[model samples]
Target: MMTEQRVELAVTKSELGARLQTSESQVAELKRENEAQAVDLSAMEDRSNSTELQLQEHKTVMEELKSTVEGLKGHIAERPKVAFSAALTDAGSVGPFNTDITLIYTKVITNIGNHYSPATGIFTAPMRGVYYFTFICHNYGANIRFGSLLYKNGERIVSMTDWQTSTDHDDNGSNAAVLQLEVGIRSTCVSHLTARSMMTVIITAPSAASCSSPCEQKTLQHLQRLPALPHVSRRPCSTFSGFLLFPM
Candidate 1:
């Protein structure tokens, strides 16, 4: 009987030991699985951060492109028109005198903000481009001499001195000057005359042929339709008549 009891005790001890080993193995497997989950979580966090950074970069680039497009649109909208006109004189003078006469003068005349003139009859530009200008003077037949066509901002592109003589019924002579301009400049067409008589000043556009329609459409119609002409005092020395045309 003692031997049988001892055998049973040993068997029970062995079974308990086996059960403990199995439990320990299961706990180890669970710990390993938890460790794998942690690694996967860390990798997912890194991927999310990288994707966010890429998205922000793309947004910034898009905004920059939008701003660039807007700037270009504004520049194109502000491009200049081809024709314009202005009046430079305010009074009339009677015949029979010789002196230096300034016919047309103005300060606020310009085709674009890029181009402007002082009130003293000068035209200037802020940048470089092809510019056309003209000045006309009416004088009596002593001798009409066209002086300097000064380009104030840049070198003169073109000029003419003794083109031809002007004829009128009252022995008056007319002179016209055409000039080509460059960027960042102004110009003045001056005339020196020997004899004295009644005069009117007219300045035409760059190419009276090409710009005529636009000039007439945009400028001349508006100017001619002004409610009334300004009153002018008569002078005895020389009559000054001023007319501006952007003829079509």
Candidate 2:
């Protein structure tokens, strides 16, 4: 009986030791899991802080861009607007003057900046800039030379002439120029006709029917005195127009 009791006590002690060893192993695994979770939480916190910093920087840049855009808008609004268009007249015809005469464009079609004068038939530049100018002339006569000249500050810049000797009594001519004008510069169109005496004149008359480019001019030295000079039409067909292309 004593031997059996010893064996049972020894076996019970061995069983208790095995159970304690398993419990210790489980505690160690639990500790390792907790440490891994702590490291993951720290990394997540760093990422979140980085994201917030980037967002703040982006917001500041957007605010600066908005301010710059508003300033540009104000600058554009303050720029001057310049454009003009005018016609000679509604009357039948304008000129056969013995000397050069500035054609008055009394009919104002569009005068945006009011730089063109219907009173003086001149366009005064309001600011230094590049401008585009165009003019049209219509003549009504047979065997008569007629045209207009664009003058800048009293000097001729360009001229357009149309002479017709055929049965067609109507002729049309137009010219355009792009010019860099300074402030206070004046531009005008004039009847390009010059006559020294009633019997003769230096004009842009075609010597022959097939006069080539830069056609030759003839002197009307002994030609019969013209009863009435060819008339430049005062209708809207004869017009002067200009606009600001870009500001310097």
lDDT of each: 0.37, 0.61
Cα RMSD for candidate 2? Answer: 8.5
lDDT of 1 by residue, 1-248 (tens): 99999999999999999999998999998899889988988888898898899899999989999999899898766654443344333343222223333333332234444233435443443334454444422222222332223222233333333322434212212233343333433343332233221122222224221110000000011111211112222222112111222212
Number of backbone-clashing residue pairs for each candidate, in the order shown: 15, 0
lDDT of 2 by residue, 1-248 (tens): 99999999889888888888888998898889888988988998898898899899889989998999899898778777899888766655454455544567788999989998989777777888888888765555466655555544344456666555757566666767777777776666554344422111111112201000111112111134454543334336667788889889
Give the candidate number with the greatest TM-score.
Answer: 2
Distance from true location, Cα of 110 in model 2, Å: 1.2
Model 2 score (lDDT): 0.61
RMSD of each: 13.6, 8.5
